[model samples]
Target: MEEDSTGPDAEVGAGAGRGDDQSMRGLVEALARRGELVDIDRPVDPRFELGGVLALLDRGPAVRFTDVKGSALPVVGNVLTDRERIAAALGVPKSGILDALSAAIASRQPTEEVTVAPCQELRFPAADVWREVVTPTFFEKDSGGYITAGMIVAHDPVTGHRNASYARIKPLEETTGFVGIAPNHHLSALARSAATAGRGLPVAVTLGSHPAIQLAACFYLGLGDDELEHAGHLLGEPVRVVRATTSDVLVPADAEVVIEGVLRVDRPVHEGLVSEYHGMYEDYGDGCTLEVTAVTRRADASVQVILPGLAAEHSFLGALPIAAGLRHALRGFGCRATDLAVTLSGGGRVDVVVALPPEQRKQAKRAILGCFAAVSMIKQVTVVDSDVDVWDAEHVQWARTSRMRWERDLVLVPAVPCDRNVPMQQDGTVTKVGMDATAKPGDRAAGNELAVPPRETMDRVHGWLTSDGLGGKVRPTPVVRGALHGAHEDGR
Candidate 1:
């Protein structure tokens, strides 16, 4: 069936139902065919080389690097480059992103089973192929190359349900790497559960799969909600998975590289000063170590790289989270917020702009506070009336200048919890500012004031004089006599 590209159903149709034969490679091929994929032939290093490419592709399509120093396979990056590309990837209009993403989340269902998987096309007994694969080149002064794009898929040992998470892995040896799982992240929670059971947590880190699956991994799903199932929901199809050769976890059937391993609970490795999404560097102490028992991949396969602290990476990572949170918050306030946008210039998730009806002015302020609460990283929010387009910066600025009053409409709340990267904050706390840019209700009727139109209207008499052949006989609207509040006026 032909899908409507401008609606929510189109985005949902991308993930409705499908099989294992569709791999990450297939999606890349489709994007490439659509002229949404660019390949760089010049030799580029993994560290700064990929960053430069990502900057160019930030508002465009995915990039494929065919000429890395020592790698025979290509390295693709920036699959979800911008909001427009994200809309294209999800099959929705750019303005309908929040609605489409929320719909996908609401319609998520459990994943279906599959027997044979393409990801297991070739298996290497940890010793053979582990040394051949190149580690991700994210930063220049890092201890070693890290796997920044791998989605570590695991199941809760207690509940037996699955989860997917994006975590960085640093190669310590040929068969061992340090996986940094944040303290409160889902994978970390699962790891803690396994530790209580006196066993290592089994996991499979899948690399270079479909963009939908990658997005699903990054989504912050609630407890018992499977990310793989969410990925299926996003793709408008079910994802195919096969049981790992060495672990109880399931990996994507079309994944390029699957590193099946177990997280050693007792053993830990020093991890940080790694680059973060905030466009800053932070040192995270000791992270879990993974002992890779087996490695699976296709022959002559390409790897994916994620550039940290950049637009392409941050936008793709932060878009849905910010949008979904804003949508939920605005709805909670009983505001008819039709659209929400977090600018890429504001580090992808910090500065937000919301569009709502002008009559609901109080709801706008509540929506702003709700956004700040939902994503603590956001430092400033601007609420615009529906008459003023939020997506257009010029229109937003116009509304701010013309409609807003300094003391009457601006709301300031101090000492709120802030993200680590906010420049104006002190020790993770700062003052948040919200501007109510909606037009003041009944300003004209309140006798505040009104300005007269500067242009003079022409009558039929003037029109006849200014008619095509008689144009020179008539003069245009006379220039205004003087400035309303000038020190001096010149008579013409």
Candidate 2:
């Protein structure tokens, strides 16, 4: 017997997720090692049960369903569900995410081209194995199975610039499906250009690469920009790429699966109900059809599924990249913000919180305006002191309530063109609001003091804080009689 060599276990061995926490498998392995990944060995259905499990664990660690009922490959979900997890994959601290992302965009490196792509080791007819591989229908209202995590890669027909972005793909037929692309997305522009020249756009959907690649794809860069190069900077190494079977477009060499296809922009189809960031279904009339040419995958690869619809993974994917851009834009506006977060409450699309020094409170207006200008999806902004954590909703709300005066601090800018998916959008425009929550100048702000318990006393009472002790009822402290007598004698 001989072991067929493919390059590493290709993520099948016992040590699969042990090494660098960069690739999807490796990150899951790392999470498992850190007790951040939960495993369900029992047989589970991918249709709704799998999504149910992921939704239950949405606020927790990553999950691996070892036996998906109808699929040959296992399914992994919620891999990048939290900021700390994302930071861990990038090998950076939570506070440094914006800096790391900004550097990656500005200092991009080229990808490494490889002859043998792990994703193409095994090839199957597109029409034959749509279900053999994993495709989960997350919600009941959804029309059918959707590939939410896949990054669609296509080069511009005019400039030859490669573009990668995340689009929802609902497989309608064995070889054809609807690709949900907003009119403003770069892929739509690319597809339109190809249609103008009387042809379908060539595209290859890359799935299960390094998490950085996914993050890179979410970025809203200029039309001529290439995110693959930026991913190299984020990964601290060049992303491995290989040519697709049906097209010249290059995809991640290490991706678990690659669905090669041609997008027909001219022939549009109903995309069914798409789960928006707002946890609601969005029916965008119709979208372009994707005619899959070939489907390739790793022999023992685990199909990666990012649970969509208000899940943490969904929010992080949409929020992190744009927040990084907003941070850079604010810097250019002379606002030295230390932290920025696109809140999950706003579906990671419309709400954001920024933190800066108290002295820079006056610049809150500029920061707010900067956010609205940078990302059209963002409709609400809150600026807080650097000491307040932007990631915590309660802290942000407290800052707004404590420091902001309703009449003076509320700022609204009207008639802004934003994401059509926004619920309040009327006639392609929406009003944006910003709150100056940073400390205000005056005697009221200056005289206020924050009370905190002594550190040593709190430490001493950690185990003793109970209903009978310090928790249930407030008890008065008694002064030592001996000390009081001594003080009285000396004073008299």
Candidate 3:
């Protein structure tokens, strides 16, 4: 409800401190104190063990595993598995999540405190600690074990702006790992820019962190914006940061695990078949390698794993991007956009349904095109009148059937930038389709029509049926017959 701000008492909770020690770890402990955390103490395998836990915990509570196979330290996953957890993490109601997230995005300011922080609680310089700290975990079938949840913190060489993002880390050994840098993702773009100047970029991959930091890393922010500030906005406080032991980049003071490294441009390694958010495995060969400079962690740390092809992963990774793009597109087209939902049915990113005012029929087409342009992954969009609830699948389908004419209402755009998971991409190109299912502004058949008795009459009918013990046999309303049946009744 309140706008974003930063101070000693930045309203993290009703009365919580905004110190470096009060990071996501503190929030999790608070949730645990409130009985919101579920600890799965049994020994679980890392391969599918975390994924299984995530599937059960989806939209539920955060889980902490005390006994991971071959490790005394616990493994924590599904911190942001559902809307409720995300709301809890942000200290907001689930219904108001988008607004709070938008507020966080809008109001972000970097911290000026230069004191040593908790993230540097235990530091291992690259040369001294590379082999001892950077441990890799395998997630998929054909890919190398990766630093699945690593947040790579770096500074843009040209602009000298700090950037933090999530990228897959493929293990080369104990100290060094290969990073899969996609072409469009911000970190990859930054790496390319630095590489062109023939300089290796310094980076730190934070393996375990609070949900706020993870959410911030997943977001697509501006070049100069500090994700730590965004994390503070999400948490409704200022995020405390500490300088990395080897690199100049700053990381969350309370992060569970941190790997300070340099991404060497000259040396690249083959990294492939890694699981992606698109619910598919992508083969990215020889992207870049992160030469580990330092690794730090809490004394009995917990490893965090992101389950690939999971609901929470898809929703958190895709929701904001789609929502921002859709919001911008609808507003740009002069349509009174009431709501937009990216259906989980389409892996939480591809299929979207937008609700708009009935009068803005033509604007729906424009909104659809704008959405496609904004988020390249969206393949199909259905526009419905505001009366039809976009969140209701049955209502949306009914509107599509009743109001949409495929030949006349469907708009097709070809050779669009498709989601990498699209099975039908010829060469990174795909087709997008938009269906205008809203009723025409002045069309006589544009509205829903139902001929029924008054509420009292319906109630009386129901009462009689129940009194006679024929409730099961009685229909709520009569089914009208054709003209022939009506003629027969008239003749009788």
Candidate 4:
């Protein structure tokens, strides 16, 4: 008998994610090796069913849907939903991602140009075929299907600085879509610059590449900054690229699919409803219309989809990178920011939790202000002592409950520049708040620190629990034990 060779798994072996870890396909194979991947053979509808499965299975293994109702292409999701997975891709531990990200940004490298690339292996010139391809309507309220994982690659026409970013693309027709570009994002700035010269901005939407690049693209940097170079720092090597067929903009040479197009300044499309990363539907109003001129892909390329909303993929993609960038900027500005976290509750955009040395607690307000200015989208900041774990929501809340004094520690700023997608923002501005949750200097000598059992005693207790079949796992409570016993007795 012959081995199976009929689906996405066949095209991309378990070794796919094990490749360079610098391309999308490489990350997929890497996930497979880690037992973090699930391949589905059942045919799925692109409208909502695909996104449904992705949302329902958030934080689980990455998924690959081999069959779509009308398209030959397959779709994959949740490749970089977890911080651990992202950390692994960047060759670092979860605790070190912020430092790794900062170093990568500081050590930018130019991409190597290749004469031939896999993305251009197959080309579709017919505009009508694009709509037939698989795309996702991630939510019920979504006006139409969208490409949530596509990375936009463009260059400043004047300075020639390359930029990569993730944007929401709503398909209006086979070859045209309305892209929601926020005012403060670098991509929006480039578009505005092009519009000033009465010209359309050429762009390449590269989908299904490495998570390192995806994370890099989410960074908020200045006009002359090149995100692709920063991606190289994460990858530890220069990324390879090829010029798009329709645009001179270079895209990932190994990307599964590339949509070569132009963002028309004169053609504005009014999208009635679209899902924002905050897991809510917002009327983006008028957006620049994108004209897809060419669709290029590998022979068996996979279309990547990021389910919008509070989904892990959407949340972490925005949260982790933004937190790292803010931490980097704060430290650069002389703030003693030791660690930081962007809360999932904040939709990975508005709320940030930071940790600093106890002695530097006085500079908490300065750190908060620097973060807000560094990342305009940040609306709330919480500062905690170095011992506090920012990644743990409970720990952060505990600090807030115990250390905060409303009148003295709460800082609020009004009418700051913010992401347009924020529902609370009126006319692209919103009120921001910061909380100093770090223990006050006076509390240090008053026994304000948390109390825990001696290390040796705790270790003995942990050993006993493990002996009782709770090895390396959170101990099951009485209720869980009762339920398990009941199920066992019933022969379930």
Q: After superposition, how far is residue 304 of candidate 4 from its true place, in Å?
A: 0.7
Question: How many pairs of residues collide in each model?
Answer: 10, 1, 5, 9
C-alpha RMSD values across all candidates: 10.0, 9.7, 9.2, 8.2
Q: Of models 1 and 3, which has the larger lDDT?
A: 1
Q: Pick the candidate with the highest TM-score.
A: 4
lDDT, candidate 3, 302-356, per-residue tens: 6666655536655665665456446655565676566677776666667788877
TM-score of each: 0.80, 0.87, 0.79, 0.88
Q: Write the per-residue lDDT of candidate 4 for residues 348-386, one digit (tens) a residue.
A: 878899888766888999998998888877888999877
- Would you list the rank order by lDDT, best first? 2, 4, 1, 3
TM-score of structure candidate 4 = 0.88
lDDT for model 4 comes to 0.77
lDDT value, residue 345 of candidate 1: 57
Candidate 1 segments whose C-alpha is farther than 4 A from its true place: 1-21, 128-132, 141-143, 388-402, 418-428, 442-492
Can you write out model 2's per-residue Cα lDDT over 355-445, one digit (the tens) per residue?
A: 8765687899999999988888888999987656677787677777777888988999999888788867888899999999877667293
Off by over 4 Å in 2: 1-22, 443-449, 453-492
Q: Which regions of candidate 4 are displaced past 4 Å? A: 1-21, 126-132, 156-158, 444-446, 455-471, 474-492
Candidate 4: which pairs clash?
Answer: 16-29, 17-29, 17-30, 18-29, 18-30, 23-210, 24-209, 24-210, 279-309
Give the per-residue Cα lDDT of candidate 4 at 282: 89
Compared to the true structure, candidate 2 yields what TM-score? Answer: 0.87
